[model samples]
Target: MRHRLYVPTAAAACLLLAIPASAAQPTPGAPGIGDSYYPTYGNGGYDVSHYDLRLKYQPEDDGLEGTATITATAKQDLSRFNLDFALDVDSVLVGGKKAGFAKTGDHELEITPSSALASGRSFTVVVRYRGTPSAVEASGFTGWLRTPDGGVAANEPESAWWWFPSNDHPLDKATYDVSVAVPDGTQAISNGTLQSSSSKLGWTRYNWRSSKPQATYLATLAVGRFDITTDTTADGLPVINAYSKDLGANDGAARASVERSIEVADWLGEVFGPYPFDALGGYVPNVPTGYALETQTRPFYSPRQFANGSNVSVVVHELAHQWYGDSVSLKDWRDIWVNEGFARYAQWLWSEKEGEGTAQELADYVYSQHPADDPFWTVKPGDPGPENQFHGAVYDRGAVALQALRNEVGDKDFFAILKQWPTQHRYGNASVADFRKFAEQVSGKRLTELFDTWLFTPSKPSALSARQAAVGTVKAPERPRSWKKIRATDSVHAHRH
Candidate 1:
């Protein structure tokens, strides 16, 4: 696997600094990355380029010790910066020199480097930390999934805080090289391809490399016993799927659904352009959680997703994110519709391909269930606040909004928008307004009212406009049970939705 690495040079570092001798003074980096909803989600003043995490885990006590080497570029002249972390730090190194460090907040590890970093100068921060990730909690929820045998680091919006120090948000994406040393029998799985594994003195170390840039939330570390399978698609793309050995009754069904990742990804490519990442696969961690996150090239699946038999719709949902969410992330968490909405719509597309239901039928059914007085219509999918970020309205009604857009713009431009959006914003972050503008640009249509009603407006879109008229027909069939099951899959905040 090939990765675009940032190799810093003295000349390059010197050229980045535009310090004036008269009025020169170094200052601390901002604690927050300027996110509106979650103000302090990620830190500012630096953009991470790559994270090399070398970790050692013991499943018995769920203890983890690791050294995280982060390569980043300074966006401004900075005296100090912060990394989101919860573990106990033993030492901190900046540019190979010991740095002054302290735990300022619940997850912020503030470090003042030995010397100020010049603007645009590439730098490295090495954090040596140890913690029980599964025990670390914030807001009364833990991101690490601790199973009987081992644990898995996988969650949305936040997870790296528990296992590794990072600029933990979707806004700052970076490639990862994860090396984990565990008991000889257990396997360590992570994002992208497994580079190599070697055992020494009662400990086995596995090395994994993710060549593609990924959000910190999407970077996963799972240490456990798994039945690993490897294959290739017809186009020769690598496929690697792993399942927990203790899945029990869910094993067969989970395998049946997740194993179809390559097939579903191939079909999604026909609609959404080529797959973004090099490796293609998913992992089932035997977790009882209800969510499945699109963790870069390798998504993390909860066993509950397949409890009711093979659920290919969920598979389609997560894999579609490889393009929509992983490849094209969000400018802010408020534009979660750009992720959940598109992923849900892809599930509808899958249902249509499988002869189960068309996107129109599914949209209408969702629209029918939520009446005029239903509070569901009050939540705007485009700018859903932090409280209702993962609301069903975002996934269900958001997709309905897309169906209306498809009808408003016609299939030609709608599909064009879907296929082109990823290409236009590949490996970058975009917002809902960005998507609306892209849609309007691609369709050559003025869709202000349509977007306002479906995305921005709070009340049920009752106005008899062209967008509503397109999906107002009352011929919706019985709601799919699998879709109902989807309502329960928002593990981040499933109860709130």
Candidate 2:
């Protein structure tokens, strides 16, 4: 379910009467993930097809150095090619041969090709580099945290190059075969299913394979002391992984909640589509920060939030991304509702199934509770404010838009859209306009009005009569005071603008 909003000419003027003095700029072009600059590799350089990584971690120095063998398909004749990587890389090699490459800023590697890569041909580049991970406040890329037991914790985002060389953008989707070698007694977990593990030369090598094409930002790896737990979904999907050093102390509780994640996955598949990945799991490292991330194959969970039912929602949120965020990703950041909104809607759907309420009840609750003064489509998915992007508007308002769409399209057509969406656009990016076109095509109805009202417009239209508000009845919740509070809050918020 998705909705759009439109403002009438005269009414739009009235609404903007109190707008802030500063004019909003037109949305910028899609910037590469984790960095604000445009990418050079995809413009006129090498097109990376695959990557093979051999990484060595140094916990004492809080750093990692890696040797990356990248195979790229050339699109044009070129004597030099540039690669997008984070600031920490040191060197580059062309076809196993040393090549001169210079570091530009902290996010790009410029390589001078020894020989021109002819168009319609493939070439390999091997890069060797080392660096200590640095925290990126811009998008929360890489950072280290101090543990309670006097140890350090680290996670990489679009900024994996703070420790390793990576393409680091969503558009450059590629298949990765990675092998991480860590110190004795420590474990390294990464995207995709684990292939095998062997100890040699006093280092443990964990090999992982991600056959599915993945955006660079979703690529991740975590290294620490962790306890492993395995399980199976009722539908027979391999659910055999959860990493947490502390799970040993609370094995019963952790296992129970972890097992419930499988049930949630099953429900999402039944409602939406297939699981969209080969495997799914989480790693709860013994870190103090209560932050969770939806990496490609597995999401990194924070143990602090897993205490009660709180972690369950996080699990559903990340799992939903396997379809919305991972499978059919957003082409640009400004269209973030494609990711966060769908994932958030899935969370609400899971809650409704777990006896939270029926779909209508949940939709009514969102309509009644969410602040209507804010424009849903005004939120540019890419450069949204920190709190507004992933959590508030992208998640809550975006889900509400979907619910609104469901109301307009009906169940049969709506679910059909959901199931076909990932399958139709696998490994590709989509925008709001693309979804709107698809919906109209499937339902055989002009939904221009519904989309305008629900998405582009800043406020909900006047309540419709029982017969006019689509199908189903919404039994208004019992709290009259709550309704009044919400209306008053919205009025005030709108007045302030």
Q: lDDT of all predictions, in order shown?
A: 0.87, 0.63
- Choose the strongest candidate by lDDT: 1
lDDT of 2: 0.63
For candidate 1, report its TM-score: 0.92
Q: How many pairs of residues collide in model 2?
A: 20
CA RMSD, predictions in order: 7.6, 12.7
Worst 10 residues of 1 by lDDT: 488-497
In candidate 1, position 218 carries an lDDT of: 90
Which candidate has the top score in TM-score? 1
Put down candidate 1 lDDT per residue, 295-375, tens digits, no spaces.
888888888888878888788888989999999999999989999999989988887777777788777678778779999
lDDT of 1 at 49: 98
- Mind giving the per-residue lDDT tens digits that candidate 2 earns over 364-403? 6665554446465455333454334443555555666677
